[model samples]
Target: MRNRINEEITLRKLEVLLAYMETGNLAKAAEALDVSTVSVHRALHSLEEGMRCALFRHEGRNLLPTEAAHVLADVATDVIKAMADGIRATRQAAGYSADHMKIGSLYSLTIRTVPDVVIGIKVRRPELQAELVLGSNADLLFKLKQGAIDAALMAMPEPDPEIESIALFEDEIYFAAPADSPYARQASIDLRQCRDEPFVTLSEGFITYQGFMDAFRIADFTPNVVMKVGDIFSLMNLVSGGVGYALLPGRVRDVFAHKVTLVPLSSQYRLRQTIGLSFLRRRERDPNLLALAAVCRLAMRVPS
Candidate 1:
């Protein structure tokens, strides 16, 4: 029983077996493994002895594998591949020499901020591949905490000790309307006057939606929301089509310049969204995160 317990399979022995099976001769297997033919023969003999099975048969000067050897080789191949995959995954989780990065951001930033950051990162590390994960502020934050994303570019939330946040720029909230609407002509729109107007806004998890609620709350009323969408572009489309009024960040003005008009909110309802980069405090030393932070700082200086 003790001998049986001691005779366990090993990765090195399995590799030698696979090399022998693929090359079909001791001299060839030795050449493939860069070892002596005697070493390859010894490994196979030890493996066969360990298993207490006839894995090969002697046919003159050449050794031929039995059916059991073929079966063991197939299973060994899978085991080797799985171990390699696990090693790669473990290294990635540790943030060691990763060639791929996952970046999370709000849908609104795709127009400029995200593109600028990605371009800068590419210039710095041409070999790195970046995948963008766009979602609401809440969704992105959730993913960041879960390690599903490397970092997030979003409206800054309240300070948290566990997160490392770098502020990029400030964007003011504006009252958005169709170009032909009467409100479009106002220098600064008063939220109090628009109390009864129907509004179209992004869903609850979005930062803009929170700004909308905050601005309205200050004006002492709840908005008459006609519809709620998930993305800023769609909300802009609704506002442009005259579906309803909306409160949007000033950053969106450039992309929808022809379709909608953005008027500054009156002092009573004024709010600004501070866009920033957020990542786990523990991962602050990660090379990818360091590159992203440098790009964000450069962008901040250029006026966003």
Candidate 2:
């Protein structure tokens, strides 16, 4: 008779055990399940813990299933098969099979990067709709965590244990100023030079805003910030009208180049913002997320 164990064993754990039972090796089980060997090992360990029994015994170099393992594996076969239909129904109920993919990003990206990426995705998949949400780095990451959005494009998002991110590319941060300003005429301006300059900045909590503050910190001076706006374009418009100097991404040079100058900074003040794609790790297998990520990676390469 098989020893009774804890009922906390999950369907995913059972699926891992069934894969291992049929394959006879970790590599084979991982390959069949399309997961890393580490994931397989972890699931197997959890399964053993849940059942409160040693399921496999080390014999020579092989891990052979024990009597308990054999009994659980026999029952797991039917359970795993039944759960497949259950998963499909649940996914449908959760709108996982929706036609549109909701993508979240900062307000600044709307000018160039985000639009191009959406176009690129549609070019590849004509039927797939792209829904965009613009917000601060904090907002986008929160929606991603809550599953309100499938993915997010953010810069140096605050580290969270529940979310996983892949940095897509690096964009240099530039000090934005009027074309005729003394700072613009210089070959390179130090952040120290801007300490007395009235600055137009994005509202705090934005990654752009954070980078702006980092430069000030490195320069050991507080900036005379005169305005804190919500979006990059608004900040640029104010800078164009000569309200104040602002720090911006190099990507904005083309759009504002007519009235503004993208001056390079000294090494001390130069900061490259890392733009990353983040999604719930559990949904890494979703085809829509995979496709959008591929498009975004490609879009970052083509000049915006």
Candidate 3:
């Protein structure tokens, strides 16, 4: 029956038949397929037997292909191409290699941490393209959990079973003020001293925002926050323009060094933010995530 014929005709046999047809000789076909001439001849013979047809005509020692052989060769080519495409599509759907990777991070990290990780990833995976999605710590963590990004670079969250983290470096929050402000001249500023000063802060979800609240809590009073911005750069801009003072991580000190001055907080109000890489525990074995983790591990060894 047709089912029995189908079972006998394997994709390997079709590949052999195509090779023989293209090369026009059993020896040449064997060379192309890296198989012995006898093996190539046997595969072609089995293919003809499965189809129950004379696909070639023997002209002395040479076997010339028949019109039926040409038709079958065309169909075999299409089948092989389709199967290859299907495999690629399936891998992409499973979050394997699709030639691109997405990484999420806090906007503050764009100054150093994100760039370092991304460059290292590119060095390890030369063909992979990377896309960066910047947002608050909570926004990035949400995106990481939803599978919208492969990984995130941000302040490490409290331990969770669903997430795996690799600590890269630690940064501290500082009192950020205009370059011309009196606080910028001091070796360190006390949060309690600024209790009555107007302040600008990043919105609720940012990692720096949490540090801001914690430091102020220790100082025992609420700051007079005049405005809340969504990003660190804008908040720094507001501080630079003398709209209000703000608290920021030390990471951005170099970025806005000329515009704003970051004065260290006194010992009582000092808070350290541990920055690191985070990904879903289930995807720990993913190739891209593995490469990213390796990069972070290397970074930990180097002085920052």
Candidate 4:
């Protein structure tokens, strides 16, 4: 009997019941629901018939809920709230007047790539605002998955199934030291030669850090990392101060051109990092976000 009763209940009937509960009169409930009084009365009758009991009893001009109706009303309230939340989420996902787009990126690209992308997007779509979040690759990926950020620019290809990535550019990694350092005068330095020197590098989870380690491993030596920092600026600062040298991307060299001297790596392994733009595949079809991505690709000169 309960299963049969539950099966007959519809969301529309529940909504009418809630409206009646709020107004205590059919005419007013219909007015609140933006329907004719007859429609409201019919919905109430259907709800009562489906439940196999009278949900409300008219006392004079007022209607009062029966015990079953009281219980169902509580449940209906929760269900209605859930439905409303679902609607809100759906609307948000559909980009219905959403004010800002949140973007995440590794610190290395934030100084150049991200700013240029933002500028280009604003130039094209002046009404759309961009919020930028800067962090490590792992941190940005985590934030993107959690929906704290809409998209991210980082080294790729990421193996996460939830994310879809587009290759932006391939940047070569070069060994850099202070201009007066012994290695600066050389056209290139062998990875094995730097094995004994103290190295300043990005912390783990960064592509550059992994590339540096891999380069050393390929050269049959392990680097002595004296310090691990979060951002390239700090790493370059350390290198400038001669605390230690580092393996950095060519983009970093472009940004910090005069601060340090970059020496090419004489490795056959082609120590290069591929930058990519990543976002959830589910969100890949969002028109606004797609447009923003298009502008970003244009700004970065990422090949389509």
Candidate 5:
């Protein structure tokens, strides 16, 4: 006979179950959560007893979570996120709330997209307060996972179950060079040409860094690197001063139009970046999140 789960399942038990599911080892999960291994073991056993089902099985020194554990883990993330949102809603209704939207973005976006998005949001929510954060792609994602930021404007990274995103547009990457360089006058530059040129790039943590590296890989060569900067404008400044060439997106082209020239990368490179607004998928239906997403969509005016 199928057994019934305990009627009074606590959130703490679910949290433990998830920790075990993720680590697949009691000791490591305990270390991750800063709890005792014995406590972690007890929690897992209590979860099994409460559900009256085997959620894990012994595998040597490891406690391997079973299919049932994985299934519950899927629901656990949503349940935990929903419960947190629920508390916020209740507190807001009781007039004990922090009424501000926190947003994160890349430094490259501060020039246009981020400012436009903020303007659109204020138009819809005149009394709304906003807290903005600017960082590398990885940094913003870490903040989003920790609930430090409600959303971000960036090149959509790989899909993660806990995240939801709305794509706004595709921007092409170009070879940026000094205005007087021969490459500046080329209709399109061949990757073979880049083989010998010294290149400047954003640091490894930035999304643009990967795209730059990928383009060079397609050419079957490594760029002769001369310097790495933290921001795009600085990278462009290095290009304009003839420090080194860089592959950069077109969105920021206008800013350096006077001193630098942008040439479309060849078809082989096929480099492009997709900009989007990303947030926790669990908050997809959240009123405030939905409202902000709507503002992003309307302001962007992109097709579905």
Candidate 6:
């Protein structure tokens, strides 16, 4: 029983077996492996002894595979390919060695907060390279899961054990409409006032979208959405064109300044979203990730 079991097979032996299987001759396998023919012979002999089976049969000075050898060859190919893939993945995760950093964020921040924070990061670490990827919040989250991005700016919800998050800042949602529209001139508007109005809103899966729904639910009203767009910009664009009103983050004021007007929602049902910088908790200790987190922490501080 002991003899039937192969001892631990080393990668080198697997390579030798694969090379010999390909070349069909010990001398040729040796040349391909950059080793002496005697060494190749010894490696094959050891493998055969461990497996208690003849891997190759002697046929007039040529190597021919046994049935078992053919089966093992297929397995070896898959194992080698998997090992190669792992190496490539590891290299990609390490990213560039320079002081550069790559960060991703939801579209809402792409226009203002993200740029301001990046400028702050550069001012502190001018030697660092900063790369930004902008996408819908859901898309950015997927990229973080795939390890394609190092960190992201997002709104927090329930706890995800695999992720770590630190609150960056909090901004309230406001009702927005075209500057010349009647809704814009109002000092405050009841959520019920817009309940029946045509509404343009963020698409599903965005934190803001959920917040909007929750706010309406609290007021015992459901917004009659006329259109659903993927990002804040599009939702606001539709509002600016007098298409409908929308619930948008306060930061939108900084970007769409004179294009739209904001009305403070009644405080009874005001919705606020907290934005944070998040990354895989397991990688929090990584030097590059840690440095990026530090920059984010500093950027979150309100200017005195």
Best by TM-score: 3
Candidate 1 clash pair list = none
What would the TM-score be for candidate 5 when compared with the true structure? 0.68
Query: Going through the candidates in order, what is the number of backbone clashes in each?
Result: 0, 0, 0, 0, 0, 1
Q: Is 1 or 4 the stronger prediction by lDDT? A: 1
lDDT of 6 by residue, 135-195 (tens): 6667777787777888889887468887888888898989888988887888887888776
52 in model 3: Cα distance from truth in Å? 3.8
lDDT of 1 by residue, 1-304 (tens): 4444335477878899999999898889999989999989889988888778999999898889999899989998999999988988987987654889999999988888888999999999898899999999999999988889889999887788878999999899999999999999999998989988999999989999999999999999988999999999999999999999999998889878987999999998899999999998988988888988998888767545
How far in Å is the alpha carbon of 237 misplaced in model 2?
Answer: 0.6
Residue 34 local lDDT, model 5? 93
Kindly list the per-residue Cα lDDT of model 3 for residues 1-304, writing each as its tens digit.
4435556588899899889988899999999999999999888888888888988888998889899899999999998888889988987676676678889888987876677778888999999899999999999889988878878988898898989998888888899989999999999998878878999999999999999999889999989999999999999999999999998998888877898999999999899999889988887888888888898778656524
Please report, in order, the local distance difference test score of every candidate based on alpha carbons.
0.90, 0.84, 0.88, 0.83, 0.84, 0.80
What's the residue-level lDDT of 304 in candidate 4? Answer: 17
Q: Score every model by TM-score.
A: 0.72, 0.68, 0.87, 0.69, 0.68, 0.66
* Model 2, CA-based lDDT: 0.84
* Model 2 CA deviation exceeding 4 Å by range: 1-89, 92-95
Please give, for residues 71-96, the per-residue lDDT of candidate 5 as tens digits.
88899899999999999798555323
Give candidate 1's whole-model lDDT. Answer: 0.90
Question: For candidate 6, which ten residues in a row score worst on lDDT?
Answer: 91-100
Model 6 ranges off by over 4 Å: 1-100, 123-128
User: Candidate 4 lDDT, tens digit per residue, 1-304?
Assistant: 4435465689999999988888888899999989999998888888888888888888886778888888889999999999988886886775443557888888888667887888887887787788989888888888888888888888875587889998888899898898789898898888877768998999888888888888887888777888999888999999988999899888877665676998898956458888888988788887657877797778777421
Candidate 6: pairs in clash? 100-129
